[model samples]
Target: MAKIVNREEMAQGTIILNEIIASRISRKAKPGQFVILQADETGERIPLTMADTNPEKGTITIIYMVIGKSTARFKDLKVGDEYFALIGPLGKPTHVENVGKVVCVGGGTGIAVLHPITRALKAAGNEVTTILGSRSYDLLIMEEQMKAASDNFHICTDDGSQGHHGFVTDVLKDVLEKEEIDLVVAIGPIPMMKFCSLITKEKNVKTLVSLNPIMVDGTGMCGCCRVTVGNDTKFACVDGPEFDAHKVDFDELGKRLASYLDDEKQSLEAYEKANKQ
Candidate 1:
């Protein structure tokens, strides 16, 4: 059983850190791999990226948000509680190289996803500049972690609470105007990633974005995680959770992602009502 060893409320706005004892998975997991875990025998399977790992301790840390019923179910589990099933180290790892100056941008939950990747890039001797953002100061996570992962760290908030008072792109644009950035990796809300792609494409800077489409089975057999990159279709669970930002068809991806909004809203509302005494 993959038991929860440590749990921390990373953010009040849905994010959490769940450290689970999965010896094999922890040992084999790479920077960009993810796992599909079920809350219980009857729980739905949900995929979460590995935020950190402790091979010696036989543990893997996953940061997630209580977005729908599957995640909200974690609220009932204690540290010692075990997940019903835990599968993978899925997806290809991030392509990290010492490509001169690297800029890693993350927003909201994406910060957690970007954490290990940034660390890897820094380890490869790239002069990493990390940009983390959130709508407000309170929602910003992994500030210290990001700082440790890059040579230079920046913060952006839609509201001027902790750092620059604007979107992350605002800071990114400023950086691009003066800096000789060699590579860029962006992970965040769809619109944010989309805009980041647009900017980098215009500047002719190579940019990559991590995709998180709806996934059922972690295998590519399901095809639910299909995404269009350039002219080819790729599966996010197997081929990537990352792709070239300039090549991805963001317009199609955005429309498909929004399809679940109504269902997600209803599920959250129903869950809230039931939990209310």
Candidate 2:
């Protein structure tokens, strides 16, 4: 049983941060690797990327949105509570290189997932530029850490609540035109990542994206994390959670992601109703 030593709510509680004690996992964890955690004895297994870690403190932090039934149950967990199961450091890590100028784009909760990789890029001597976006100011996260890792940092809000008054692509396009980008990495909602890939493709910039399809098993055996990269099937859990965005088929990924939307809503509704008692 891994104990959650700390918990924080961000993005107006739409996102929750849980820092669980796992010394072994922390020491071996790398950016882009994830953990499959069960909320309780009978809870479904859910996978989440490691947002940050501290081996000295024996903790690995993960940030997640309260999107569906499992996460909603996760929201009910408090600090000092223990997880049902914590399996970790899964998926291949991202490749880091000093490719001169690199641009990192992160949206919503993905910002946290991208943070460590961005920091690694900076440390590797690549000039890092980061673009972060969310629906509004309140939804924005990890501003200071990202700014610290980046040589240049840009932000956008869909509602113009803060920073640029439009989509992140608006800023990204401007950057791409004015500068030479050696590499681009994006992680976000399927639509946002797809759009980022589309734009980067037109510019002929090499781009990478972190894919989060429906994953029942963190290992490749379940086949739930299958995704098409260049029209060939790849398992996100094993082959990659990171793949060349230009080669991915976002249309198929998007449809598969929405498969449980209705069930999620019904579960959320039931949870709320039960909690009112």
Candidate 3:
């Protein structure tokens, strides 16, 4: 059983958990890897990227937004609560090398996943710049952690509630115009990442994006998390949750993500009705 060491609300519907797991997984985890978790015996398994890991402490941190029935149940868990299954340290690690002047952009909950990658880039002798954004200041998560991971950081919100009064892409464009950046890494909602990739395309900067598709099995056998990259189908579970942003088909991915919306709504409604009774 994996015990939840701590749980805190980072935003209105987002929660971050520090959980204890087996030593083996912790030791193998690298930046950009993810894990499959089940809250209880009857719960469905869900894939979440590893936000941070402490090998010495044998603990892993995951930050998630509560958007579905399974995630809602996860949010109900408190400190000291035990998880039924925490199968982890999965997927390919980000290909980290000292690619000069790297810019890491994260939106909403993606900041958590971007944190470790930024740290890895810095350690690899690369100068790192980070941009974090959300709809409003109150919805932003992991600003401090991301700031600490990079040499330079910028924050953006849709409203002028904090930092720059525009999207992360706006800040990214400004920075790219001024600085000679070698590589760009972005993770967030599909639309946000898509736009970021578009902006970077104009500058011809190499951009990588982390994808979150509808995944069933964390392994390749399920075929549920397949995404097209450069006209080839790749499984997100095993092949990547990260791929070249310029080659990705965002329209197809967005359609695939919406395929389960109705089923998810029904499941949530049923779960709520049963609980109320």
Model 3 lowest lDDT segment of ten = 13-22
lDDT of 1 by residue, 157-255 (tens): 888998899999998998999999999999988889999999998899999999889898989999999999999999999989999999999899999
RMSD of 2: 0.8
- Candidate-wise lDDT, in order: 0.90, 0.92, 0.88
Q: What TM-score, computed on C-alpha atoms, does each candidate reach?
A: 0.97, 0.98, 0.96
Candidate 2: where are CA atoms >4 Å away? none
The worst-scoring run of ten residues by lDDT in candidate 2 lies at 210-219
Sort order, lDDT high to low: 2, 1, 3
**Model 2 misses residue 54 by how many Å?**
0.3
Candidate achieving higher lDDT, 1 or 3: 1
- Per-residue error at 111 for model 1, in Å? 0.6
Clashing pairs in 2: none
**Candidate 2 residue-wise lDDT at 70:** 83
lDDT of 3 by residue, 195-248 (tens): 999999999999999887877778899899999999899999898988999999
